[model samples]
Target: MPTLSDHEILTELDDRMQMFIRRQEMMFVATGEPHDGHDCTFVTGGPGFVRILGVNRLAWPEFDDVSLSDAIADIRRDPRISLLFVDFARGAIGLHVDGKAKVLDDDAMRRAYRALNLDPSLDLVADRRPMRWITVYVEEAFLSAAGELV
Candidate 1:
């Protein structure tokens, strides 16, 4: 058996990975604090809801109705987070992204929203317009195709 190191996992998003992320409509987010139990939630949106901000950064909007207080609180205390995206319909593959996440303020949220340049033709649900944004600074990314992590 081979051990995996941080260097072995991809830190930047490649073209194919970016496409995979953009096409997925849902993602599972996991967060935990040092002494507290972990929380996992599923967030769904239009096809391109999550956007890649940079090679090592990604941001996703949080709608008003969704309760992310637990996750947000955990992140504030301990920034560690993991996001999982699976191609259920097409490729049947999954990607695991581990990073530090921060809840962005109004200004930052607006900026991130605008940066996405979403298509006007797409009818985004009125209520889903992002009350806030969570930006993840990616540290390590593992692809299922490479191998299982545990």
Candidate 2:
């Protein structure tokens, strides 16, 4: 097998990858702080609940009554985070995003929500606007192929 350098392992998201992300309704987020262990949780929403803010940034709403404090606290102390989105039905196709994350306050959340311009009538964003948002600044993106980790 040929050796792969970091440059070869990491890549920017292309149009096809972005489309895959848009179709995902669930994602797994993993966060960790030095010497504090790591926490991973599954976040779910309707399709398109997670928005790509730019080529290198994405944001997802944080709903109330969820047990995400450990993950959020870890992010505050150490911004490093990893997100995984997979197509279970199809299998073997997924995307891994490694990045830094921050919890946005209400004002920033509102601005991000507005930027999405989703239909106000959509149940996911209508009366249930999230007060908190987690924004990730992507450092690298990788494609998971046939059970291999990139």
Candidate 3:
């Protein structure tokens, strides 16, 4: 298969692709580290609005969301990270994104938080505060072969 271009990646994320991602409940995020590792988190959100929360200055979401400090440090150390999404349904397509990610906590992030009703934990609390959000700047993305589907 031919490698996809930046434009192609965005096109794949159109309405249909977003639906595919949301329909599934989980995805895998592989971050760069000294030993290179993978973290799987419930996709707690849909496209255009993914979230990760924290306390103090560290951002950790559901034990899976990589710490902002760690992620940023990783980016500085190595900006190569890949996110893998697979659909369990039949004839399902798989999406793989190789990109650089950064933590975003600006006005845009605040707005995103308002639209979401998420809890790092299942229990609801009267007073809860979030830490930060990880904004993935997708660089390369594409579909995997059918054989690769699981």
Instruction: Report how far off residue 73 is in candidate 1 (Å).
Output: 1.3
- The all-Cα superposition gives candidate 2 an RMSD in Å to the true structure of 4.0
Q: Give lDDT: candidate 2, residue 2.
A: 26
Error of 1 at 10 (Å): 0.7
Clashing pairs in 2: none
Error of 1 at 15 (Å): 1.2
Q: Least lDDT summed over 10 consecutive residues: which range in candidate 3?
A: 54-63
Better of 2 and 3 by TM-score: 2
- Per-residue lDDT of candidate 2, residues 50-104 (tens digit): 7887778888777663668899999999999999998887675878898999999
User: Candidate 3, residues 6-71: lDDT per residue as tens digits?
Assistant: 324541244444445545555666776667553333344333233323111111232224433455
CA deviation > 4 Å runs, candidate 2: 1-8, 112-114, 118-125, 146-150
lDDT (CA) for every model shown?
A: 0.76, 0.77, 0.49
TM-score of candidate 3 versus the correct structure, residues matched by position: 0.54
For model 2 the local lDDT of residue 39 reads 94
Order the numbered candidates by TM-score, best leading. Answer: 2, 1, 3
- TM for candidate 1 is 0.81
On TM-score, the stronger of 1 and 2 is 2
